[model samples]
Target: MAAQPGGRRGPARGPSKGAAGGQARGQVRRSWLGGVRDAIDGLVRSSPARFAILVFATLVLITTALLSLPLARAGAGTGGTPLYDAFFTAVSTICVTGLTTVDMATHWSPFGNTIIFIGMNVGGMGVLTLASILGLVISRRLGLRAKLMAASDTNPSRVHAGPVSERQAVRLGEVGGLLVTVAVSTLSIEAVIMLGMVPSVMAKGHDFGLSLWYSAYYAVSAFTNTGFNPNPLGPAEFFDDYWFQSLMMLAVFLGSLGFPVIFALLRTWRSPRRWSVHVKLTLTTTIVLWIAGAMTFLVLEYNNPKTYGSFGFVKTFYEAFFMSTMTRSGGFSTIDMADLYGSSLLVTDMLMFVGGGSASTAGGIKVTTLAVLFLAAYAEARGAPAMEAFGRRIPRDILRLAVSVVLWGATIVAVSTVIIAQITKSALDFVLFDVISAFATCGLSTGLTESLPPEGKYVMAATMFMGRVGTVTLAAALAAAQKRQLFRRPEERPIVG
Candidate 1:
């Protein structure tokens, strides 16, 4: 092609046209590079909440990919599990739910177990939060997006107030301190339990090395609220050991209570009279729930032959405590859950639905949200203008958010349970339990997970993700589509019972 400008020879015009074409290509290349640079900058400076969600999604994807690999599946027993099982397992791990489609001990090799353990750690701590923490440790400065992401992960509403520089720093410090404390406490307790379990495990004629491995695996698994057992050995063999069961129960209990609650207790311990309202409420609710659940389990299963199964009164109480605590989120089982009677199953479902505390590894709607809702209801009942708990008035916005979260969570669980039941043709109780287990990220099941159809598996996977990130967080991310308007619609009253 020739340029059609000015008075110029055709031959001269041809060179000019070529020069223009070269310049145009150069401009296009520069524009493409500029676009790429802008994208990188945008990603780096993206909203922390968005960044966190992205990171979490990426981690889950990576986990799913790894679990799908033939090499990863190698030696995981009987060659490899179904792709659905692997995917479900990966989702369960990333969601920090202990539910398993396959018996972990008989199926996975040591490497697979390690992958699971790491996934547990990452899941327990928010993936983005952990990444941000690591970045802070190495760089000593958080990017703008990292700070915002930290705030969102810890408390999303706080991000709306302003730039969360100081708050992010404080929250990050708290998280780091909490992790260190949990690690130390978990290791110490596990070490003691390992020592205790060694004798018992060795007594069963297992080799010392294998016994040690089992002890370590159980220790980490229990504390992480991961119900995985490295040994295919059933609970029947260890059921009679009171001390072992008690030790495991304690680990599960501590693990179920979120790290923030633990840290709050520790801080209160340092100054007995000056506990924060949050600390007091969390401790009180936790203690009350534990005692009430244990008692309820014992009373409900007292005459039932399946669960108590001809045990003495003392043994009954011990088993009851284990069941209650495990149902809270631990997923560990000293008894076959399938053996539990109808009443006992209902009680366990209630416990699983209530779940553990906020900002912790444990899921469910969260104790804090529950507390807030109850307090809000009480305030309305008493004709009070504001919601108060433990002498502190919870902000109306927070209360609204809490209620929304609980409702949304319940709805998700309910819908998913229906879908799962339809897909699997399982009994309502077992399917509901599985749905609750996924929603609470608790992982306990009545052996229904493996039997679930692929559709049911997908439902559980979605439930697990929602439980981990939380309904409110997901809602907020999705709610960004709603634009702000200068004018508000008039409030209207609706008829009600």
Candidate 2:
């Protein structure tokens, strides 16, 4: 959930710099574990998507094992950590879905919290993506077969085996180096956000160490969109300060924009035109949703005393904006969602279903999916031959993929809602919100999470796991080995939607 080299034939080479950390370079031989890892590596190189799913399953198992330990659970609640509870918590945290059966602050020890932190940090990107990035960083290369499987060069690729041109070497370097920049950028932003949020804790008179820990935990959580607040007292404690609120909002905003967008923008700081079309579509859709969702919340919750009504205009506006931002898989809420108006809940459900951008810490159908769906509709209505957005033509195959993702996501959410409603005896709307939150990996709950039964919790864990891995990825895995058709079938017109 992890870094550099120095080379050769220089000066008097004082005992060699690579060995300066006390361990000799290449002193340790590969273990039996490395053989197991190599087998897994070969599997990953063979089928990145399928292997990525396997890796996530394996991580969840590892996380569950750690959580089931006696110390991972508190000595307080329910006497002992139930296997289901530990398993559910592991899934939620590893999926970066904040649904929890026990109160995180009360139930988990520092060791447990650290485990959750590691999970969120690694799970911010899909497991396969993380593995690919790590493979590049540690090995300084990715397999050529893996490269061809990738939809973007941002996904790592292997260095060629034979003689290479200078320009090709530079390109290869950038491909591998992108992972480093992504890692560095994530840590740096989180650090700044932690600092920005620190003074708020100090103002509350919390001890320095506790404040630092809280600040760090939340910075990681917020940026990863896990939204698992570590404070025992909840938002009423340290987060009462407006400055901290703004910083947290900004952190969530950046995190949900997707890593590739951030990397491109960071690397090419000033050039708007140089940004990729994917980046442009993501940013534009994100911005539009943020503003529109904020406005919708303000309009709907304006008079609801339980939410923004009591705060008055200026404060309410900010709160609304924050809530709206949080809705795009931000997962944190300043007000009681249970108390919000039905209309507000409906709006929130929609936003949670929409989720954040692709390749982001956020979940849901993804803003790009929505953009593609809408653009395809526009193209169809105009009788145009292609779907175009921001002057780039979107392939018909992409449109089909987008529709499949949305439909699959919606189907999962709908089924889960019914199951949860039956188990929890919650109303349909409330259950729908919870289910959609789980499905989108948004983690926002309407006070129903903790009240759900063990079975209910398991249902959510399954939904979160699938959502985090992606409905499309899961569907593809399940529908493995697409058989090639030997003969073309006749096309038939079907009834319209």
Candidate 3:
């Protein structure tokens, strides 16, 4: 009608503000997405180390949010978890570190526990390795770059600027197999362990349904080296359950061996000579530490009535061995850590500091680092030009990397320990023990973690984050912050003690 009135001309129209606004919004959205895609590509291509740290940090944030929900607290829908407790628990869970600022068994609802269970499993899988596996699942094939990124998890040098040597624990060609191995081994090991613990859990007066749940939880916790106890009595309920204890110890040993070592062992079980240097060193060093730690604990705690004094010879040996396994980042503890002799605590600190194998679920500087340092010392004692192990020579770069990891880990622990001690004014023994436990991702505590002030808890959470992300990975990320230099500086030897 209006058009007809205007003689075939429409009435004057308004500016197409809605259309223009929509178009502008679309452009902005596209630009933001494009920027994100480009950044992700750069991250995946140039530095998987950075990508890994980013992933863990993201998971921490997400888990924190989930744990902070009102439903996450036990017996309460109205009262939400404290941000401090939620954040600390989130860090500990995602890091697969067992240190907690709250009561794990009684404090959280089933929803919170489920979140923790999922977080530990995801965190236990190496970050870069998980990315590669996801890539494979999505595309049905892993690209060369993806393989390189996955390899970097097993061997940090893959992310550094240099030609990758053929003498690797996992060759580039075998990366696809390694990915399969990681997924399969994690599932199979946890499943088998879960089934084995069902009987023991049932013996504890839990119904079949409850037993299954507890069994599965313990299996995951043990395999992930996360010592979170779902039972109200803690490990004390299962203290005398030999079958459960043995299975837990076995699971922890296997977990601490690292996925690369596990893969290698699976392939070369029948031929030890064919095992990679990494596998050999990890196994040998792990065995040595296990035995030595047990003996040290047995000797130191045998007379302490507060600890092993009440136990007979066999029980004392068993508990000592169990604690030794836990110190290798297993985190499970049946006795009061405060009752341990100071000397025993120092030994635990050392073992925890050494932690587990490279790329393992356990934390600390890693068993491989300890192995490498020892190998280097032995070589130096013999005046060899390079560190040698299992008939293979380790590169100087690896040795330097080991030193860097140790230094980085020690610095983190030292700084956190000082800050926490200052905050709580606690005894150095207890402070140092919990700090190392946090740094090693070992859950053993002198009851110090829960008593710490909020500031101290925050410090411990940061320590757990750094520990689980790994000192080696952190060093690699920091190294990647600067481009590789084309020029070299003159070398000078400095005298040292």
Candidate 4:
């Protein structure tokens, strides 16, 4: 240290100017961090899409973990299948697909059933939206990415363009409130249905405890568009019970109608003349689809012995209604889906392909997308300048998105069907039905699920996940990797038929 350098006395004694400079830099970093903290505090808010995805993923993980537990296995009484079965079941539930390897009634314990019920609810409400609410409640700060993601997920056109800070805050509040209201209403309706069914279930010779369990399980399942049933006896036991079936159908239909329709109804209740155009369109499309689907199925299967089975006209009508309702995203089946004639199967496949409405627990290409695509096509056919529906002009971008979503969804199902056929050597009809069911998160099976190999099951699992998360989401994520400059190039024409 005697001749270290001509620096400060303290630095010359032990260190040099470099050490003091490093200390100063550390202090500056601390100060900078403090400023960053302040900036973050100002920008803190919830992100609905991120929240929904995170929650969905977390629930899937938790469900898997619970199913893997020793207690859960013991309750099943045969080692409860393998890790993959549980993992797939968890994913299916979180995705709101009712497909299952093991029957819920015969295999899972009450606790396990409860977990499934929760999964359905979580999936129905949307995991990302739920998670965003949680983050808002906890820290009152949602990242910008979360907000942008939420906007993308929920349709950014709906987002208001106010002051940046104000708009985000408003959106958070509105979405949070809307989600809570929908969830509450859904649970309430399910509770009422459960209570109503308890008596019917008891009358069918089920014990009080069993009846209660079955009623609750069915209620949750129906209300979330999850086709899982707590009764091992299957739909046969309830086939003759008109009231029970009706209640189940109602719950399923209501659940599959999508949250936007529900919100529209609520808004109408509050102010009849104030219903938004989206609400009006959603209700009209939903009602029309319901009628069309029900009528088609009724006509197609009215005389089919496998479907109607010589039941009275009333029962036949009820079963047709049930099938129509269930096929639009609900997985419940009053008759054996495998026994349907080729025509009936084709009708069902079409219904499942169109799916339920947007922003609903139900899946498929989404009724709104189908509706928009049809409108756009019709306009083009008529040589009209704009796409119109419910007396309002539908934006070109929205129409394009709808078309994209449908094409992507159809492609996914087609590819998945081919892959499943290769793996299982199943007939094309059954394999296609299974693929569509999984892709739509409809949960209905043509008995192929039990016969599927591990690879087949995996394929179905992937389809279910994609169906629930949305083909558009997956497509966007893939496209994001190839992002380029916003500058547009000159348009070029391509040959077409």
| Candidate with best TM-score | 3
Q: TM-scores, in order shown?
A: 0.83, 0.87, 0.91, 0.84
lDDT of 4 by residue, 268-385 (tens): 6677456655565656777888888888887877788877868788777777778888998889887788999888888889888888766677889877777777788799899999
TM-score of decoy 4: 0.84
- What lDDT tens digits, residue by residue, belong to model 1 across residues 53-121? 666777787887777665565463456557778888888887788888777776776667778777876
Candidate 2 lDDT over 197-248, as tens digits, reads 7889878888999889989988988888888989877665744588888888
User: Which ten residues in a row are the worst by lDDT in model 4?
Assistant: 160-169
Whichever of 1 and 4 has more TM-score, that candidate is 4
How many backbone clashes can be found in candidate 1? 2
Clashes of each: 2, 0, 0, 9
189, model 2: CA deviation in Å? 1.1
User: Which has the higher lDDT value, candidate number 1 or candidate number 4?
Assistant: 4
lDDT of candidate 3 at residue 46, scale 0 to 100: 72
Report how far off residue 358 is in candidate 1 (Å): 0.9
lDDT against the true structure, per candidate, is 0.72, 0.77, 0.86, 0.74
Worst-scoring 10-residue span by lDDT in model 2: 155-164
Choose the strongest candidate by lDDT.
Answer: 3
Instruction: Summarize candidate 3's per-residue lDDT along 204-268 as a digit string, tens digits.
Output: 88999989988888898999999999988877899999999999999999999998999999988
Error of 4 at 322 (Å): 1.2
Clashing pairs for predicted structure model 3, backbone only? none
Model 2 vs truth, CA RMSD? 9.3
